[model samples]
Target: MSILRLPARQQVRVLLLSSLVMLAACGEKPQQAGGEMKVPVSVVTVEPTPTEVFVELPGRVEAIKEAEIRARVNGIVQEINFEQGSDVKSGQLLFTIDPAPYIAQRDQAAAQLKNAEADIRSARLFADRYAKLIKANAVSRQEYDNAVAQAGQAEAAVAAAKAALQSANINLGYTRVESPIDGRIGRSMVTEGALVSAASATQMATVQQLDRVYVDIPRSVNQLAQLRRAMAEGVLTRSAEGDALAYVLLEDGAEYEHPGKLLFSGVSVDPGTGQVSLRAEFENPDQILLPGMYVRVRLQQGMDEKALLVPQQAIQRTSDGLNSVYVVREGKVQPVAVSVGPQIKGSFLVYKGLNPGDVVVVEGFQKIRPGAAVQPIPWKQAGAKPGSQPGGPAGAQPEPEATPKG
Candidate 1:
């Protein structure tokens, strides 16, 4: 029946029902369109690539050569020769001790030697005369033998006097304290007129060579074992010569200008710490590296031929210490658990739970959910050059990774 021909009350009721149906239809159409719309996200395609494997560890700086200047003889310090905190050469006079007593002893030894020489000459002349007389039967054989014995005793006295003189001279030389090495000397321990003794071996000063330095890093035994196993299993390949390069970060968070090389790995493990010592030599011509300074060292040990990596931003860390990333599969997002190794550049080295040709979400994380449709786009990092790869060598991290914590 036509609404116009119905009763007034019924017509009003029919019009209200029609209005409600039209409004419901309008809402349903928009809801269906929203479900069909896909969220746009930046992603990266995973591919196997070669990359250097390194570990960053805490290390201490040490001088390449160090020497303690000590008193070698007992004497009063007469003068301080070298300036405090100044460079010194080998054999350079650093301090002068009281030399008067040593000088008198040397003179006494010289005079005794001279007297002994005179006695030896006179005794030898008498022995020569007695030998001739005995041959001519003018002197008794016993008398000639006594004369030869006296000459031999005089010669022995002369030799003893000469040795005494040499000893005195050596003691005199010790009065002038000199540097044993070429290095920078620290403050003097004793001032002028201060008594120093050889018996106690009093330390006078310190000298250290700063042109080069050694960085000592300790690695846990477990880490060393893992690294060895990786190499043995062909998971990581070392350089042809088995050599490695080392770089350091200063305390101020600046990278050291010069690079260093591995010196040696200690064979014995430290009983107290359960760690092995590793030393690397670095050129410190500017003397920027001081002994006892703490630093972070990046040691490149091996290469990963077919390594998988993901963007640092893409990895999500949970409160339980688990790491995961969003991966797009068949135009849908899925959460995947991954085992991450040390961070390299701006990406993390993936050890597990990722495969080649996988698309990983790098941006628009908040808009994504499990099984949600997504429109993946190539991820472009801020400040990155054109055509640069995301989370690749084109980007860098502010700090090096501490491998132990990873």
Candidate 2:
């Protein structure tokens, strides 16, 4: 059955069939050694580790000591001694009020006192002479009584004059305004020659102690209750230091260089916000922290002796806002729902739905589906140093579900 020995038309049909067969053979896909291609993924074996837990809350910076410099007496501002926005010492003269009027009042009071003293001396001398004359029967009893009454009135006048003099001296002293505390003074509210009044309590400046600042943190009452419950249940053990240790983060996201200590927790809750106030103190020798600055406080709430942590990237959220992770079990991909808790160091505390020894994929999950076989590999964090150990336990990875940014 050689095609070359057949008729010319049959030979042509054979040649066409031969060409079709060769094309089919060239188009056929080559068979691989393995039965199915497994998707390569990075994974981490879940393991329990001892870790510290922290709670972060919004806080406000406040000066520990604040004083409003106000006018204590009514007068025209004669001088401003300290520079604006400069450090000041206690009892330092900050301003001077017009002292001319006060001085004149003081002098008048002194003159009145001297006059009252002279009148009292003359009245007392007459009263003494009258008493001696009465004993000797040299003057009428009625005249002696009148002299004694006149001496008593003079003495009362002298006392009133002394009180007036004291008041005048006090007023004179008020003309020289001084700082009551050691702190940094703000801008002068009143200029030189400006009229200031005691009645109005006109503010001249502000001084605040900035060397140490207080961080006021307010947490909702509900949150405090939950924390208490956790502590009671033995789920969260309070730190031995309690609220003593604290860390602050600036508004610009930079961590403050110095650490702080908690002062006290408010006994009463705020009626408006139902929040309990907490205060912490931090050394601000550099004066970087200013009053009213927005900051974040990190407080160590408790410790979990045995806890499971998953990389933040491995946790997946669905459209309805449920969290899950792709776990590799028995060489097959499985989407397992997971319950997560507070995050620490780019990893989340897995409170539920995950167990020790579970291989969770951290990368390359997009290419696979449920029940699909995968080749799990050590998931190395990007930008890691050369020859560094992989991320997480044994290194996990993720796929179509987006990898969350740390």
Candidate 3:
């Protein structure tokens, strides 16, 4: 068995046979690698369900009603009846003007009326005496006529004085200013001891009703038209009652607790921005929403009964603006073009090019290629593999090793 003892021809034949065996083993290893390698991917089964579509837009808060308090009479402001920046009711006294001048004028008119009444009594007695004298043929007819004329003049003077007294009384009542509406009042504009005049009435304060507030939001006219077209084509269904439900999102991303209803949408569009105004009413009993505060409104536009939804991460838009998704069919990965609609809750509403129960690749997309055989696994967060019980198969097993040829 020693090498030196073997013949030359025998050694050469042995070397050739060993080299052939090594080459066959090397060729078989590559065949196993090319045929059995399978890409592992996570997939989701597509399903149809009812989906709600919402439109978010910017808006501002407004008070339901606003009133400006003004002075109505000419006088000096003697007292402020209500506290500044406090809630006030209709007919509540807010300010008091000095009433001394009006009172004095009223008293003078009353005294003049009393004097006129005295003169009327004296003239009536004289007229009666003249009438008796004329009947006795001792007085002239002209004298009796003069006495009757005097009595009529005194009656006219008494009527004038009474009219003056009425005017004074009205002016006296105007000294007390009252609230015009029930609302929260702003700071006093004119303080005590300030002169106010009816010729140019001074604004005393402002009162605004805040129990119920209005939110004015602007929406693009073009977008609204598109929505209407979609509804007419049966792609979307509006609420039966016509009005949409609305919610508010604060700047900090907190949602308002109370919901609001759409009141009306403007028929005319703004020429500059091409947007239509929308108004919504919300119950703001707590006064949390202030006028002019910036907010975001989530308005429910419509609903779709048979909507196909896919996670946002699964969608890919090519450079040519074609949207597509990777789908797993019969253990093979393939890309399918899809028509996507508006996004709802972090998912896109697939309008076309997909069917129910289709497996969509949600993860491991980078490791897969078109027409490649893949091991579809249930998608989980991150790359953590699903745990398997002891002695149980984790996933698809590797292809059985090829038997060596003789």
Candidate 4:
């Protein structure tokens, strides 16, 4: 069987046959050589659960009550009684105006009142005498009438003096400016020796009640209308009487420890922004919240009893902006279109196109194609090590295996 012993044509034919056999072997598919192709993937079985929906809106902190301290009388500021940025009580004296002029005016009014009282006593005695003399005809009728008229005029002057005295006393009391509310006071706008007057109404300081604070949040009018429509359609549920709960996120991204209650939602939209205003009340005993500070408010709008949730990573958006998810159906990969709602934590609320008990691939979707057979594995979080199984022991059944497919 030596090629050298054979003829040239036979040698050429043998070489050609050998080359054809090697090419045929190389052309065979790898899967056919061993077994059917199966892509390994992680999946989660969909389930319906009660979920709470929250709307986050930008808000600003405001004082529950704000009072502007102003001078009520014309006088020079003699002293500032309270330290700048200190807490003050209601009716506590905050400033003292020079009381010299007011005191002099009050004394003058008192003296006038005393003189009027002396005149009143004299007039009463004269009127009594005139009445008796006229009855007895001891004095002429014209003389008696003139005496009675003088007494009445004196009485009228006394009444006017009394009113002037009261006015003076009131002005004297206004010299001491007091806090109208119990709150933290700001810096003094006018220092000692500065002139303040009632006519101009000079601002002395500002006080704001800070034990409880208000958070004013502006929400889009369109968004609010959509939420109402959803509620009417029975897609959302809320308590008819009680206010919704709220939580605050500070500017630095830290959440406040205490929760708040929504006070009210505005009925009218703002003309400038077309937004509805919402207010929440929070306990700020520590003064952690200050007026005009910006914050984010998380308001619980409503609850959905039957909500479908999926991991955010499992959702894929195509070039056309259509959202979709890949699911394993009948041991093969399948693509499904889904309508997603607001994001809840790390998951999204699935609104449409997906049913409970469907196995959706959360990982390894890139390795599988439509209609391709896939070996579905339990989906582990990103924190888990590669090849490690989720859930408990190896004997534990996966969620998809335990749940009855719809």
The lDDT values for all models are 0.86, 0.83, 0.80, 0.82
Name the candidate that leads on lDDT. Answer: 1
Using lDDT as the yardstick, the better of models 3 and 4 is 4
Highest-TM-score candidate: 1
Q: How far out, in Å, is residue 334 in model 3?
A: 5.0
Q: Model 3 Cα displacement at 306 (Å)? A: 1.5
Q: TM-score for all predictions?
A: 0.84, 0.81, 0.68, 0.80
| Model 4: CA > 4 A from native | 1-36, 137-153, 239-241, 332-335, 365-373, 382-406
Sort by TM-score, top down from the best? 1, 2, 4, 3
- Put down candidate 3 lDDT per residue, 352-393, tens digits, no spaces: 778988899888878878999999887664443454111110
Better of 1 and 2 by lDDT: 1
At residue 227, what lDDT does model 2 achieve? 64
Model 3 stretches astray by more than 4 angstroms:
1-33, 102-171, 195-200, 240-242, 315-324, 329-342, 352-355, 365-374, 380-406
Give lDDT tens digits, candidate 4, residues 1-406. 6987889999999889999999999898776466768999988888777666676778899999999988889999999999999999999999999999989999999999899989988988998898999899999999888888988888888898899899999999899899999999999999999999899899999999999999999988777767777688877788443678888887776779888999999989889999999999999999999999998887876776776777788899878888899988889988898877666666767777789888999999778888989999978777767653222110100011111111
lDDT tens digits by residue: candidate 2, 52-138: 566678889999999998988899999999999999999999999999999999999999999999999999999999999999999
Q: Supply the TM-score for candidate 1.
A: 0.84
